[model samples]
Target chain A: MLDLSRVQKELVDCNRDKSSGVSIDLVGDQLSHLAGTISGPIGTPYEGGVFRIDIRLPDGYPFEPPKMQFVTKVWHPNISSQNGAICLDILKDQWSPALTLKTALLSLQALLSAPEPDDPQDAVVAQQYLRDYPTFLGTARYWTEAFARRVSIGTEEKVQKLVEMGFPEALVRTTLENAGGDENMALEKLCSG
Target chain B: MGWIKVITKESLLVAQREDLRNIMDLLEVSEKHARTLLIHHRWDADSLLAVFLEKERDRLFSEAGVTIAEPNVLAPLQSSQVTCNICNEDVSADAVTTMDCGHGFCNNCWTEHFIVKINDGQSRRIRCMFYKCNTICDEAIVRNLVSAKHPDLAERFDRFLLESYIEDNHKVKWCPSVPHCGNAIRVDGDGYCEVECSCGLQFCFSCSAEAHSPCSCLMWELWVKKCRDESETVNWITVNTKPCPRCLKPVEKNGGCNHVRCICGQDFCWLCGCAADQHHARSSCGSYKEEREKKTGQAKRDLFRYMHYYNRYKAHTDSLKLESKLKKAIQDMETISDSKEFSIKDFSWLTNGLYRLFRSRRVLSYSYPFAFYMFGDDLFKDEMTPEERELKQHLFEDLQQQLGANVEKLSHFIEESFDEFLQVDRIMGIRMQVINLSALIDNLCKKMYEFIENDLLGRLERVTHNIAPYESKGVERASELSDSWDSDDSLSMKTCNVDSYLQWDSSANGAGSSESGSPTDDSFDQSSSLDESGCSSRKRAKKEALDDPPFNLNLPAEGFDKN
Candidate 1:
């Protein structure tokens, strides 16, 4: 009845693409609410480990940006660790009807890789973020492994990674999403776009 | 696609050099259009638009909407009242908007709130007017609500509202302000403090000054309006301008020209309100003698009317200074007499009353010469080091300025820090004989009741810094390093990072240097409104001192403190 499917498809697509290596894991079902995994983007502290992400789409479809929360603990300027609520303009005050869930995930992946240190949602993280971007990356990657790597059977590893090199599963999922969900496509997307 | 002589697409593509560059400037053209154009015509970024222009005759001009010829399109109505969400301004009915929640507000106010994210081009997520539900509005309601009311502004501001456009943080981008420069700057929106144009132009968003334009939205509106009006006038006059009748050279006049007579024996007529032809109108009806007499008579009556407001502004400035002096003296007395000392309290009250009385007089003082002094309240508490309090006295002055200068130099400095701040303070101190020269100026201004408090004490405040020990004063030494952050999550909140925020690392005019200085440092002293007051309170304290002083004490009446 609603355009939820279209918006979800876009989220699925965006989750697969991005400069930040992205990975998505469907813990439960894909049509309703879903949990995804992403590896740490390269050069970021979240490089090695896996990170979990949750996407909750409303019935209104593309008109509303989906509510996404980081299931894994990772340091970021906009994301609050207390609940992993993000402070990106596109997701909150700037939610556009034109945006789909896929775009939101890709944006989140981008936010993870290159965070803003000026208008920080997290004051502490922002301080460290402005003072040292590299160090923030270190802890972010470390946390990704500590939390996101937990996977069992029947769980589809739909994660995407975009940025190559040191970027782990988080980027892998992002890459996968950007590449239209094909591993080779992911590599090609990374090399090209 | 070329409308000219028949030319193959291959030949045209080979001839053009910038086919690829033009796509970047197409603000309205979709990215898909660029891809299609590139594929079909093989046009590069520079010439894709050219190819489009070859098809859509008025393409680029139509996109930018450069046509605003009708100035009288809307007649100026009288006393129109439209409720605004922020204020009850009287705007036109067409400017009013009623939200779905039944809130009525003018478009101007909504736009002001909506422009919270300037770079992202997103409208501010305004809170509901209803007191009960203070929820931040989503774009859906704003679109539906504003459209039903003022469809024009809603449409105009809608593009500015990015709430849903760019989901998930794509990199922050900016409108390239340079000529022919269209690359969106992938900048961090957190600091959003500075914008470095691709042309290597740097500007501050805080002052609206070059390199860093930082005025608020209203000031920006005024400045932009002025620039636009000027540019429009320039462009219009340049296009259809009449020549200086005699010289036959095109002329553009900024000022009112009632008698724009040519060098030739021709008189221009102001009464007609239009340009005159070869046969010009006669001047003054040959009654120049009578008109001169009449104007001479009017001058006398207008002088008093003119002085009335001027005098009022003068009185207002004087009272402001007296209040500042009294307030400062009282604050110092109170701090020293924390245990409630009688002499300190008595002095504070005495100065307060004297300051108030002077404030009430609101008269022009022509006879009394003024003076200022910031000597250590050496007479006050013995336990607290006079040096610290006295140097801290300079702190009160420096708190107001980021890069302090002489008391006279005070008039010159407004926000721009020296090459270095601390050393400048020390170097500037050496120039002055006083230990706390900056404070000495403030004290001197207070003691002498000098006029131009902004010029004097205001400049001394530049070198002042809000300092806290890197490590806590207590045993924990816990940096709470996180405490300095604006939020636990934003990660981009850039406040409290002193090293990154406060620069001017160069030797501040040899400030700290023991040699080559003046006597202003003798009175150097300091306050920090509670740590919670923020840098703004300091700015306010300085501005308020000028606006709300208790007396018109113009010290150094005859250039005594002149730099």
Candidate 2:
């Protein structure tokens, strides 16, 4: 059993701390699956970008560490750019049951400011970070701008596009919102329905 | 000689308790605290005490996460509700438990934490749940709280704690028995020694491989892998078979003709291994080629070299297998001699000589592979000059040849039908020869081991190889640790003292050399008694053998002479 009460309590506790700039929200109806977003630390290449993380609480949650990975691809040494995987000791054998989702997210946020090149999830990025610092910083900043800085795709444009595909304007708007403001995805969902 | 003690499932608790008691007594701590210290230091009490001497007492205790709570402290008030930091839930005092480290968590949270750590296989050391608190949670509290929800997992926790003595301790190892005998062996001295388990399997304690004394553990490991790999067979296959030009399947040349036809209906020139293409009928492809000759020549040389060593190794192993059957024949001969009209009843020398033959034959078989590695370019190529290697090779081979010849002669003499000899003088002549050959073979084996140790391996600096010293009494059978835990305490105290064990070891070594004279007559008496008393005496004899001094080789010849 997942100890749903503790996870529920953790959610309430994390949300109460709005100043921490790290928050976890349920991804869907499932409490075990969550989405965590953290603002990159100030004065770093990742600043001004919101890094989305996919969080999964295994059944032995809190006792076993929660599995967290980068969802919004950010170029970093200790995180895989190809597939958003993290290399953090807290996520592995060093995980203590006392740690929670908020602390883990903070750790991941802290990792953005200081990447561990020696123990790397992305070998290419680690090599780049080790051999050429300026190039690595520029590439990382570019990746943040391209992928992580959420381009609020014009919601009005998606609503219009889905509505023109012959769905109700209200349904199109909800579907577009559900599809994260993607016009084509909202249209596909409308047509499939 | 280092003493190796076999610890059966029945004795594991006894073996571990002794160490725990020593730590408990020395440290003036509870059993749980002692166990924590012992488990941390890998059950080496001396090292744990050394750490105590080197560091402050409080530092040592705190470093291992041991916090001994002061006695006579009042319990926390039972009336108030407390909040568990883990779940952040307010619960009544009775619903929460406080560990000795003073970290309190609700029972529900504690059970959950214990379950998680146990499932993660970290049962031996489940720390208190407070962040940055390193104190290990008391085992009793974990057990009491866990068994409430899950009895089986609590049992698993106990098992894990019990098995840590073997799993963590370097001196102790589980017998590498398949279908596991549930027995572990502990060596009191040097780790590199041979021990026979109570399960009747003798293995090198260091590598857990079969007892191969003259061959170092590395050499034995390589020899076993090489034999299992059948590299020589593969070599022969590569030498004889050529791939078909069309299908690429391996095709063997069954005849002397250069034109060969594959089963796939492809014709190829055997010399060039090329598809026929109008060149097959002319036999022009048979012309000498340097490349082909060189490749085949190298393969031929490698195959011959492998065959030379493999044949000798296989020959002795086969002889050993065949000679094992001689045990039954010798037992039958003993029965015949017992019932004969003649007064000669004792045939202990025959049985003793037969055992010597078996032991020597095994040594002789393994010696071939040992020689293969010792003299070949594979291991010691740069260690010795070619001339030095040749000199050492001759010295080793001479001993090997002498041992091999004497072993064969001992085997032959032991197999003779001496009970059929009506003349007492003829039987005596056979007995003298068997005894003399047994002694000679034992001496030759010891000499060969000495040569291998001092002459061959001793000179090498880049590599260090150690063989289990030759034991004339055969691989030492590890005696069972006394099942009583109290005796183990004294035994461990003696082992820890070091000087006493050294004196005992030296004295035992002296006794061992003298006892290497002959197999004791008691074994013959026990076997004879078995025949007279049916199956019961055999069981008693086996029990007696386990308890008896392993080597009692100095039986008087007059006992056999009178018989």
Candidate 3:
């Protein structure tokens, strides 16, 4: 079983430092699934964007490392822009149980500032980062601005959009919230239902 | 050649203890600490010692996460209560466990952590629970705490630790027997030799494949894969068939003009594999095109070359399988001869000759592949000049032919039922032929190996390929390490006992006398005479017996005919 108490303590500990711009919240009632947000490191291509990460604590948590991936796509060499997978060593075989969720998020924040191009999850981005630094930076910044930054269209606009798609207003509101305020994905969920 | 030692399940601990004792004595450390060091160095004592010499002792220990701290440093406070960082629980000093790394956690939490690490296959190096602490928890403590709660996991931990000696060490390997014979082989020297496990399976220690002496492991691997796959058949098909232009199905032209129509009603040219139209229907596709002719000619030549080697290799391999049936027939003939009150009581020569045929046939089959790689442009093209390669190929093929001819003669003689012959002289004559042919084939095999080792592969400098040296008697059966090595007394005496035990085991297994190529009576006498000696001379005698088959071919024919 997951060390729920340790995860609980980690959540409380991470939330205590909200000013650090990294926080984790439970995705569901279960402590096993969580969502975290980390502000991009300053003076990097991803600056001013808040990247959301999906975190899952396996049954052997603390012993086995938690599985974490980006939910909001940000272009980086060591992260897959297509699926938001990460290729950090500490997230893999080098993980120490002593390291917490907050430290892992901080490592991601550091990875954004200093991308290891040699060991890459995105070969195209890594090649771009290596061969043309300016173009890579511009593309990364564009991706961060387009995907990582959350747009404030107001709640009324989202409700009105879904209502126009002929979804019940209550269902639209909950599905919109569940989809994390992504309008196209909310439409997909509504259409699937 | 390297000495291959077969380590059975019963001798695993005894086998590991030799290394463990060496490290412990050298470092002046406890057994657990030495094991930690060995595990960290992957059970290589020489490398561990090299690191010890290169680095400071404290650094060596600390780098491997081995902490031999002063007891006072890890001693608990006078206060009765201590808090374990893992569980965040308060426990009395008695309920807490302090590791060598000086990190203390409640016994419950430590036990849980050990269980998790052990189950996760990290039993060999379970680190301290404290965050970022590089110290590995002392194994003795892990065992003691974990065994208190779960004995099975502790047993698993111990097995993993024991197996790490073989699994981690480069010089040792488990006998790759299916259903697992519970034995591992350790090579004390070069690992390229062949060894017969105590379970009676012979394999190359390096590749774990069947013994393929005179063929390097790479050659043997490629040859086996080539034989297993339908690559030759595919090549033949590619050379023979042309795809229909419309259906794209392969169409084989039996004996017709270039303009052949497929069964799918698609007409195609066989020569160029292009669609045929009404405009040049008189087989104009057969007109010579340099590029197409060159490509087709090359493909045909390659296919023919492969077929030549494959056919010969397959022929010998098929004969080996067929000759195996001779064993049952020979056994039946032995029974018939035994009941007939024949003059000759011993017919081990027939069985021995049959065995020689099987061995030589295998050598013959593998020799084709060896020749394929040696003389061909695939591997040794740049290693030798054309003339040098031609001369060496002829020398090798001459030896191959001599061995092949004698092997066939031996096979023919062994298949003869001289028991049906009423004349004693004829049976004795057949016996002489069988025995002489066996010895001749054995010598030929040895000579071929010499040619391969010294003349063929030996001349190459850029590529290093070592084959298992030819053993005329057979693949050497690996003897078990003596049980007395486990005890702490009389090392020389134990070594002597292990030698005698191996001889006794070989004799019991029936390979000793038969492989030595001596009549059963001579081996019985030699073994009995060696039994009287106390120590070192027996090993020397055993080694001599293993090197040469002690057959007295000069004995008069009347001596055997009088029976």
Candidates in order: C-alpha RMSD to true structure: 33.9, 9.3, 8.7
The best-first sequence of candidates by lDDT reads 2, 3, 1
Q: Model 2 over residues B1-563: C-alpha lDDT tens digits?
A: 33788787667887898899988888899999998888888888889999999998898898888988755332775668887777778899888887777777789988999998998798888888876678888899889889999999999999899898999998998888888988899998888788877777888888988878778888889888877787666656668998787776679998997778999999988778878956576765767666543334555565557667878988998999998897777657655655565466666677677778888898999898888889887788899999988998898889989998889887777777344645777777788887777777787888998888888888888999998887777877666677564454333332232332333334333433343333332233333444455544334333333345323445455444443
Quote the RMSD, in angstroms, for model 2: 9.3
Report the C-alpha displacement of residue B372, candidate 3, in angstroms.
2.1
Candidate numbers, best DockQ first, in rank order: 2, 3, 1
Interface RMSD of each: 14.7, 1.7, 2.4
Against the true two-chain complex, what DockQ does each candidate achieve? 0.01, 0.51, 0.35
What TM-score does each of the candidates earn?
0.25, 0.81, 0.79
- What C-alpha RMSD does candidate 1 show over the true interface residues after superposing them? 14.7
lDDT of 1 by residue, A157-184 (tens): 4342233343466666655543334444
Superior candidate under DockQ, 1 versus 3: 3
lDDT of 1 by residue, B131-246 (tens): 33323444554565556656765765454432112121133233235563332322222322444332334343333233211122233344345445654654465455544534
